[model samples]
Target chain A: MNPEMLTKWLIRWGGTAAMIAVLTAGAGDGVAQESVAVRAALVTGTLPLDDPNAAAWNNAAPAVFPMSPQVHWPERIQQVTVQDLTVRALHDGTQIAVLLEYADPTEDPDDAAAIEFMVGDKKAHFAHGQPMLLVEGGPVNIWYWKSKDNKGVDLWAKGFGTLRPHEHQDVKAKGEYANGKWRVVFSRSLATDHPDEDAQITPGQFINIAFAVWDGRKDDAGQVIEKGSQKAVSSWWYFRAEPPPDYSGYVYAGVAAVLALGFQFVLIRKLKEGQSA
Target chain B: MGRALIRPIVIMGAMYAFLKFVLPNIPGSAEIPASLIILYLLLTLSGIIIFETLSAESKDAFWGPMQRFLTGENIGGLQPLRYGILVLFPVLVGWQTYNATAPSDSPPAENRVIHPAPPGEYTGLANPVPKTPENIMQGKGFYAAFCSPCHGANFDGKGPAARGYNPPPANFADPTTIAMLQESYLFWRIKKGGVGLPIEGMPWKSAMPRWELELPDEWIWKIIMGEYDGAHQTPRTWE
Candidate 1:
């Protein structure tokens, strides 16, 4: 075909392909960000607390986040047993539950998992909160679950060495270990009475959250190999109790589309006038 | 309506896809930031447009189809296509605008000096440790013990502790990073780490620990040599 005919033919099909590509470009997971938000899907019924394999969990999407060794402090662990964490969350308007799952080769007594949320409006460094001397944000509220205790503890931390239990222990958790994997579930009320100590989970807002896991590998004498800061950790990710459907985004986009069409029409008219002149 | 008009747009799109998607996934490639991508595309578009429109015949070949399409001229069966483009163009623009204006939970992009100037005393300083094979081997061991936790054993910066930190660890394997820097600058950065950066390295976001207190000066020099060797790059010369 001649170049003119080829151009016309190409334009006919290529234009359609390009349009489709442009429309779907947003869907591509191009590059991995440092951390992506873990959404807490809204559900109509009660959350499946203490149940990792509950039917209700199927409604929520799981986000697998990479975990790294804790190398910030002097007692840091260079190697990490847990390389990634599978997290799922659900909220039933009043209560929120999070399910944490990871692979563990051994079931020593020291196996534990914890999730931390930024307490108040300020933002702290992801590696536990900022140091107490360099505290630029509010404290971090941690919900810790241990395999031995088979329960969760509500704790608060200002920095690395300042972890302490909250006055009101409102968080609850349960763990199940089988076939070299540990599935743990932590649940708490969306809003707590203690505003100063606990992180309030409000709908339609994003909050910073982090995770840590201890594999509980023990020495020959039965001493825990992973202790204190020697564990796998994740940086601050986002947690949001998804709000009700908002149509304002669509409305704005529709208006903008109409305006853009009008601009194109105006541009074509001007071009025609210039051609005639 | 010849290939002249459509070629530039197609090239731009292909370049964009390559830079935004294909390049980052390559084993040793570094990601080009969004701002840099836009600048590059703009330059490429201008260059192609200049070349295509330089001659009268080529100019007509390039602009004829576009003008005809706009005026609904010789295009017979493509009338529906013109309308299709009219509708799709607005939607694409609107979608892009919406994304740009949307409020996000992710932190705002930060600007920091990738390689700030070293202190006066440190600028002229030299690596005391020789770059012998044995020294390089020792440096490799030191790097594995200290740097590999965050910088990665492969020097790709995907170390076990690298994921969580924003302004993630530097991939020394990328030519744009270690290969472009002076040995003395690397020495200064190693000794001081993140806390030692000047004001331009704002937010002090680097998680690099100061090795001055822990490792001796010779060890730091050795680590630098090992880093260059492992990344298969050479330090920039003073000349």
Candidate 2:
């Protein structure tokens, strides 16, 4: 057997193999990549995070980072600091969420946590046991705020497994913002059959929310609204995406392409020999 | 037989690498970075390679390399650029597909356009909303009624409540020389509220009902444009 003939076989196999490999990998990823649609639009919302008595202005809340209901990846909220703080409620028809932002949470020398908010002029607090009201029925939202900060470990509220309230599951969360404040939203997602239900939502609803953040404590001097001096919630909004498809299609298509290409190559080779004869 | 098998393997590796950069950027793709592509490729490549190695081809060889491989339609004399362009085929297809499907943002929520306020001092209105001489003075009044509390009287963003706010009020008088916004810029900001600006930590309009409702459009314009302008302090005439 000639080594030169063997070398020729090797290169022929190598070149064909490379093209096959490229198509296989290319098609698989291409199919998967094509399914996705990427987007990044500037999302802005405001929430209150300051003391009631510390008065220069109490009405307006600045735009907060890590805005509401978007689940915060474990320690992702403490990335910013707040010089002054404010909190505003955002009411998406079904529920209320919060958005928080702050002074350079990245560059600060203070004792303040990454996120904080004043509920009734006192530091707002939430944990596993508390329950905060989400809406007043004044406004309607298209979708609820799921966790916006998706950590690698989990699919978070919307994409992966959700904390569905089969009976009375504890749904507790603390909203930290790029601003320096840790706000806790501890609520329980009651059962679907529960009577206290405001409204049920199909998977993909609108994401607009309008919050009515008030002192939840007492009212100041002159104000028409029910609660405290300065109170307003952030605008409403939601996010949605169609997930990627399964890979079974790739397997079948790949198998067929290879088989067909092989059969055709063989048929052509035989036909060439037959013509020569 | 051998070439066909190699095709999928190498293609898979390169494809894995390229897609790694693409996926994580898909909006909310769990901040997982691109380096993870290498990890997935390693784990997947090994498994795939193992699977293919056991199933080698069972056929005799075909024509040798010396036997000319030609285009039947036109005895093939294609240019290098042609091949180069073909090489870029996958990349171009991927990019075009992304562009078509990717979510381009909605035109920034019809920005708050500040229609020149009704003839006030700036407009020199007959009502002369406030008794101030300059719109800057009216801006002071306008801000005092609204913005100054959180932002501060001097626009130092040091209002009395300035002590504990996340993203303190923007220092309008920052001597540091920031965005040299135009005359009507402040009015647009004030009226539109902070629907999408960097006044983080404070709620939009900060309880000052969309000034569109609270102040006559004129006053909101006077307060923001007048008092916030650099003309009084920096000596540069309002361009």
Q: Which model scores highest in TM-score?
A: 1
What are the runs in model 2 whose C-alpha is more than 4 Å off? A1-138, A141-206, A209-277, B1-91, B102-142, B156-207, B210-239
All candidates: TM-score? 0.65, 0.32
Residue range B22-89, candidate 2, lDDT tens digits: 66578877545557766777677776655545643312112221112211122255445444543454
Shift of residue B106 alpha carbon in model 2, Å = 9.8
Q: Candidate 1 chain B: worst 10 consecutive residues by lDDT?
A: B198-207
> Candidate 1 at B75: error in angstroms?
20
Candidate 2, residue A10: lDDT: 90
lDDT of 2 by residue, A1-277 (tens): 5999999999999999999998888776342221111111112332221212222123323333222211111111111122222333332223333333233223212112211111122111111101112211121111112223211011011111232232432233333334433342312221134223222222232222222222222217543221211222232222221122345444554555555555545655765565466
Candidate 1, position B178, lDDT = 87
Sort candidate 2 into its docking category: incorrect
lDDT of 1: 0.83
Model 1 TM-score?
0.65
